[model samples]
Target chain A: MAIIETADLRKVFRSVKRRPGVGGAIAALFSREYEEKAAVDGITMSLEAGELVGYLGPNGAGKSTTIKMLTGILVPTSGSISVADLVPHRQRLENAQNIGVVFGQRSQLYWDLPLRESFALLRSIYDVPRERFRENLDHFIEILDLDEFMDTPVRQLSLGERMRGDFAAAMLHDPKIVYLDEPTIGLDVVAKEAIREFITQLNRERGTTIILTTHDLADIERLARRVILIDDGTIIFDGPISRLREEYGTHRTLVITLADSYEDVQVEGADLESREGNVVRLRFDRRRTSAEALIRRAMERYALSDIAIVEPDIDSIVRRIYREGYTEGAIGSPS
Target chain B: MSVVFSRPRFRLEPYVEFAKVAMAKEATYRFDVFTNIASVLVRVYILRTVWVALYAHNAAPSELPLHAVITYSTIAMLMSLVMDIDQTRILRDSLHDGSIVLDFTKPMRVPLYFIANGTGEVLFHAVLMIPALALALFFVHIDVPSFGTLAVFLVSFLLGYSVGFCINFILNCTAFWTLEITAVQFIVTWITDLVGGELVPLVLFPAALQNVLVVLPFAAMFSTPLLIYVGHIPPAQYAGALGLQAFWLIALGAVSVVMWRLGARRLVSQGG
Candidate 1:
């Protein structure tokens, strides 16, 4: 059964229309005008327990709005949602007990207090059993390496250390589900990898359902097996990460460095894109022709010093999906 | 019936925990506490000297003599310190930075959480303000009230804090609509200072103005407690004054709740 489910969830934001300058401001006070913006327009998806799904979207694509609605921070304009068998907004406290949330841009811990104090406050807030709290704390501290600066004030910790602390803070209650929004944002490469490893281990060890929304494609590639693409407040694509490659990610690039300059280089099952000096670029469809076959043909035709085949990264595939709307074959593919 | 019975019991533990954390956080700013105490003493000294000079210039003694006025003013200043609601600024900053969304994710209601936190800060101020208050008493001729009156004053003071907190809470709710709260804060502070009877005793005002101001919630914040402390409000009127304070407490509490609900609906957190 799905631990989190939303059916046609929608949110419309209403904002007052203001004219420029003092005169416009005065006019607005007299006769008000409001503009309606659909921030999250009819999004529907479900996440099974222990499933890691990446909610991918460009800025202002309503990824955060959807997460907010699911976490009961913002009420949806319409539709239904169920997390852990309770309506998030109506049964907020119960839902809060079952789910943990973290935002990279904000620190939920107190700024002036040491991390240990903040964790203690959370323990009381969630009313976790003492033994269980200790167990979870010890587990996360060891995995995230939080003992080094556990007694330092949050304000004094570096952004990387603070994020590690936040992750541990969110999971201290042993919640069944966790929502991480841009958890790896503004971190060094080493810190990002450490966070990703912790997330993967948590899921594997505890069966924690993780729904992550992030602009960092690397986060999605490393942590999420399933991807849900959102655009303009709506779901554009939902499938496995590989399906994104299989459908829109069909083209692969081959770059060859030649031993000597050649005027005409021809190879079957591949189109020559460009050539400069001793280097040549070729594009091919993986479904239609194998890279090995094209390489053999290229070797037969031209003297090559080095050849490299590059598969399109998830970033480019997502960019393509955004550039060209999701094709029919890519829509609603089984994950 | 099952839904009602199964509903979780409202627990005070989390609020107490909030207070504990807030007090710990406030303890870190020891320098701020010292500065606050120093500022309060300086303000009291300046105001006390000004009141003495005014009374000396007037040949005909006022209804409240110089010593009584000085005592009332000092107590009012101390009450202001206890009733200070600086958490409004914290709430506004949280809203501005969009960290308020994290607040909403908590199991507790925002208003209650703020109140609990504010109460903790007030407790801290009260503990530290005692010495400054003691020093000020040595410099001024304060007529100590009877034990019964002192008890009444303490109760009124607590109610006044509630009223003050509600007013500030309502004002902070404006952050949901307007990003700038400084202007609103300035206006509210001006009104509170003028009519709350912190700077001048309400008894000295014209008869009609005094009557009107006494009924206002602003008077409940500072005037009521100060009046009780100085014996200006006799024991006979204690019940009526306490009743007025309770009325404003409930009225403002309801208004803040309504405002919070509306403001939360309109809350468009700036960032994702």
Candidate 2:
């Protein structure tokens, strides 16, 4: 069964229309003009237990809005959502007990309290049993290596330490699902890897359903097997990572270095993209010709000293999806 | 995994924990505590001196004795300290920075959590302000109420605290609509100081203004309790004064509840 399900979820914000300058400010008070903006529009998706899905969108693309609705922070204007068998907005407190939320730019821990105290307070808020709280605490502490700075005040801790503390606080109740919004944003590479590894372990061992929204493609690549792409408040793409590659990531580059300078170097089923002295680059569709076949043909035509095949990186694929909308042909394709 | 204890049913445990954490957090700002005490002392001194000078200049004796006015000023300062709600800035900051979304996601009502946290800060200030109150009493002569009146005063003070919290909660709810709450804060503080009898005792006001102000919720927050404290409220009117306080407490509390519900809905819809 799906741990979270949303059908045609939508949220529209109505803002007062204000004119510019002093006269406009005065006019605004007297005149009631409103403009409606749709932050999340007609999004339908579901997440099964232990499934890790990355929700990707550019800035102001409604990624956070959808997460907010799912977590019950914002009520939807239309549609229905069921998280952990509870309607989040209608049963907010009950739903809150079963889900955890983390935001990269925000710290949920009390500013002046030590990390340990914040965790204890969260435990109380969630009503986790004392022993269960301890078990989760010990487990996260050991896994995240929080012993070193657990006693430090949250405001005094470094960004990485604070994020770690926030993660532990969110999970203290052993919530059934966790929503991570840009969890690794603004962290160093090492810190990012640590968080990614922790997320992977959490999903593998605890069956925690995760909905990750991040700008960092590495986070999506390392942690999420499934991807849900949104743009302008609508879901544009939903499929496995491999399908994303197979569809938009069709072009592959093969670079070959010749043992000796050849005036004529030709290969079938591959376009000679560029040539630089003894080195030449060829482009071919992965669907049409294999890298091995291209290389075998290149060897037959010229003396090859070295060869390298470059497939499209996930970052580029995601960027392309954002720049140019994904086609409907990519949906529901097998990995 | 080892066998673990089952999760317990939700209770007031979280609010108590929030209160404890808030108290501990306030304790860290020692310099702020000292500054608050100094400011309160300075304010008391200024008000006392102004009243003494006014009394000296008056050709006719004032209705309230000089001693009684001094006592009102002193106790009003102390009452203000105890009844003050400290979550205004926290609310504004949270809303401005969008952390309020995370706050709403917690397993507690936003108003209750804030009230609990603010109460903790009030408790802390109440303890620390004892010495300051002692110093104020040394400088002014205050008439002690009878045991019955004292009991009435304590009840009035509790109601006053609730009134103040409701007012503060309502004001803070404006954060959902406007990000810059400084103007709202200033207006609220000024009006509260004027109408709540924090700056001038309600007894000194014109008879008509006093009649009107006494029935307002602002009077319940400061003037009602202070009147009971200094024996200014007649024994016959004691029940009426307490009843007025209770009325405002319930009425303002209901208003706060409505405002909170509407404001929370606005917050969610507006994507705060």
Candidate 3:
């Protein structure tokens, strides 16, 4: 079942045209010159129940704007959004009851109060049943390892600890869907792993639909099977992670180390990418020449001591796509 | 489902809890509370001295005596402890910082939460007023009105507060159109201090102008309650004064509701 859906969703922000200098600034006050930019332009998509989808994009790619509309914070300039069978903007209060949101850069926790007090206040705000609230709180405390610093003020907590508390707070009411925007923006390896584990558990155990927007590719790689890639306010790609890899991730890197130093080393089918000391990096298309064939050519040409073929990671592929925009063939059309 | 038949169920628990949390947050800064009380006391003493000096020159009229003026000034200062608090300051701050988006995602009414938070802070300052009032009483002699007058004053004061809140809310809503409102806030605060009868009684204005000024909402917020307390407005006119306050409250309340809806739309459209 599709738990969330949007058709041609769009959000346009109209701002006064700001000028360069002090004189221009004064002129703008009287002039009504306006410029409109569509932040989320005609995005159409749907999410199935219990699906963990990575909503990926670069900065100013309308990722946060889309999330805001879905969360009913930013009303769309046009188009329709239905989350849990209700229009999010029109039925915002009802939709809010069914959704949870976490903005990693900003915390919803009270800064002066302990995590416990924040949780207790959320309980009243959501009107969660006393018994159920207790159960959820205990579960989150155990899972997020929040027992040690539950009484510490939010301002005093480390980023990781506060994030854990935030996750718990957003989930206390058992929302049917969760929107996590950069949930792991700034965290150490262990903290990142803990959050990813918690998110996976929430989606799998509770059958909750999750739409995660993150710049961190590792977060997308680990938790989301399906990914939606958007840029310039439109959907460019939408499918499984494997399809993303197959479409844009065709380049392979071959690193060869030579025991004997040669003034010049060259392979016929590969282009030299980079070199450090004795080791040389070569880039080649996987479709044209196999790694085995490339290795055979390098071995015959130079006295190689070690050779390894590196598959293109999602990071490099995404970086390349950003540098050179994707084609319509691999993209899902915006409805 | 008929809309008229189906009354919306208003939840009070969330606002109550929000107010409580706000109170708790306000209590955390104990030193600030003490400093606030100290400043109010200092101002009261200065006002008492200033009024004494002004009366010595017989600049004041016979209808307003020295003791009555002292009571009026002292009560205005005390009333300012709660009334001067901009309940919609949180709204302005949130809009500026863009944290208001999180508030829009909440299940409850955003304005109500701001009100509860403001009420919590006002209640805290209201408690501080007790000590400040006591200290002011020691410095100057203030006339205590009869029990009936005191009862009427309290009712008028509440209406005045509602009117003040609506005005503040309406002003903060301007932030939706203009991202910055600090200059506007300063201008409005200066005007309120001058015309709201906070610094000087409206009765002292020219009798012809006094009638027009009293009908203004600014006077409804400060002058009505203060005048009622000082018996400048007699028993017969209590109903009239309270009724005008009620009128302003409803008028401003309706304006605020309209402004709030329009402002919220602007905020969401601007992607705040």
- Residue pairs of candidate 1 with colliding backbone atoms: none
Fraction of the true interface contacts (Cα pairs closer than 8 Å across chains) found in each model: 0.39, 0.65, 0.58
Q: What C-alpha lDDT does candidate 1 achieve relative to the native structure? A: 0.85
Model 1 CA deviation exceeding 4 Å by range: A18-26, A263-269, A274-276, A330-335, B1-7, B60-62, B268-272
Q: What stretches of model 2 exceed 4 Å from their correct place?
A: A17-29, A257-280, A296-305, A330-335, B1-10, B60-62, B85-88
Candidate 2 per-residue lDDT over residues B72-191, each given as its tens digit: 888888777776655545666788888888887888766667777877787888887788878776766566668988898888899988888778877887887877777877888788
Instruction: Give the per-residue lDDT of model 1 (tens digit) for A109-134.
Output: 88888999899988988888989999
Screening candidate 3 with a backbone cut-off below 3 angstroms (N, C-alpha, C), the clashing residue pairs are none
Ranking by lDDT: 3, 1, 2
Candidates in descending TM-score order: 3, 1, 2
lDDT of 1 at A255: 93
Number of the candidate with higher DockQ, 2 or 3: 3
TM-score of each: 0.94, 0.91, 0.95
Clashes of 2: 0
In the range A1-335, model 3's lDDT, one tens digit per residue, is 79999999988888788889999988987886899999889999999999999998889999999998898777788999889998777777888889998899988888889999999989988889999999999999999999999999999999999999999999999999999999998999999999999999999999989999988999989999999999999998899999878877777889999989998878987888889989999988777788889898888889988888899888887876777777745433211
For A169-254, candidate 2 gives per-residue lDDT tens digits of: 88889888999999998999999998999999889999999999999998999999999999999999898999888888887889
Enumerate clash totals for all models, in the order shown: 0, 0, 0
